[model samples]
Target: MIGEFAKRQGVKKVYGIVSDYQVGRDMWASLKADMESKGIAIAGIDFTPIGTKDYAILLDKAMKSGADGLALIVVGGDTVTSLKQGGDVGLASKMKVMGTMLMDETQGQSVGAGGALGVHSTLRYHFTQDTPRNKRFVAAYRAKYGELPSQYAGEAYDGMSWWLDVVESTGVWDKEKWVDAFRNSVRNDSVEGAKRMRACDNQAEQVGLFGTAVAGGAGQPPVTMKVTETFTAQDLFKPCQ
Candidate 1:
């Protein structure tokens, strides 16, 4: 999706850097295949093992790849360390960077302002979502938990809401009725926006977001992820179930 996003931005080529885990390898492979179909060549690819520290060689190759964009497929502490090192080496100015498992507040703080600026990420939720339902949920969550809600919180709320609605309308929570209720309902007023559980796959079809990480001032987390695009349910690609 990041490659597709880059192509939409008119980027013709990109380098892919992923960690040496099976998950990272699979992600890069998928990206390479997708970009090829779109006429966007992957200029180069590399993998970093877990706990690997130095990125100077990888950064050098990335700068030399002549690609104007990058696909990063690493997670957790590696995400922070690599972004910081990539920034230190001027990779951000030289290329448009996109990645998985990013735009997190904790990672942003570790990456800092200079390191995180211009990094783009796609994610399921962000606490700063401006929709009215989201705003109310965030306010209530903060009041109760003394912290911003995560995607887990959103998932819990959506799950319970769906069941409650089902129980209210039918007054029978039998297996057949429960399944029917979920499949038939359209939850337009969800905190995350309009959603419908796909009858074919039983997955909630809702909006995903693309965001840029920016520095937040005092009293807030060190970094704040702000949404730039709201990808509708129909915009998501679903496979045969």
Candidate 2:
């Protein structure tokens, strides 16, 4: 979906910057495949060690690469620093900024709305999903925690909710039985909407949300993602083997 967004924005080439780690490598690979498959070019790629602060050189390289966008595949604190540096260097004016999990509500808040604004990203969940169940979840969560929940928070809550349901239905506490049940379970009321566990990979098959960072509106946080596209589980995940 990020690739689709890039194509929609006429981004023909991109420079990839990712954390030097297994997860970061995986994310970069996926983005690379997606963008290339859409006929977009990967102009160049670089991996930075986790916790490395200065992104001036990297941001400069991306700008010099003649790419139309920066494919950022960093997470956590790295995301905050690199995004701030990207803004500091005025990279957004030179190239579109986007990639997987690049900007979420917390990171957007940390980077400030102006820094995160217009940056594109994709993830499994966002607090601003306009479903009744998600609306309820966000309201209750904010009422208790005094802020919006992140993707991790939503996943944890959904996992626990599904687990308790399976436990109650099976009338057993055996881990083996729970694992088996989990492989075949589905949650219709998940905060991110309905999803089912794929028996083959034991992965949750759910919606993929694509959005750009924008102001959170009146009485809201400084920033929030405005979902621009939604890919169904069937459209995203491959068939179970």
lDDT, candidates in the order shown: 0.79, 0.84
Per-residue lDDT for 1-241 in model 2, tens only?
A: 7777787778899999999999989878887998899999999999999998998899899999989889888877888888888877676777889878888777787898656887888866877777777898889999999988887788687788888898888888798998898899998888888889999999999888888888888766677888888888886788987
CA deviation > 4 Å runs, candidate 1: 163-185, 217-219, 238-241
Q: Report lDDT (Cα) of residue 58, candidate 2.
A: 91
Q: What is the TM-score of each candidate against the true structure?
A: 0.85, 0.90
TM-score of 2: 0.90
Q: Which candidate's lDDT is highest?
A: 2
lDDT of 1 by residue, 1-241 (tens): 5756777778899998889999889888888988888899889999889776887788789889899888877877778788899888766778888886565665677888777877888867777776788899999999998888765687688678877887688887587887888887788778887788778877888887777777766656767776777777666656546
Worst 10 residues of 2 by lDDT: 123-132
* Candidate 1 TM-score to native: 0.85
Q: Find the 10 residues in a row with the least total lDDT in model 1.
A: 232-241
Highest-TM-score candidate: 2
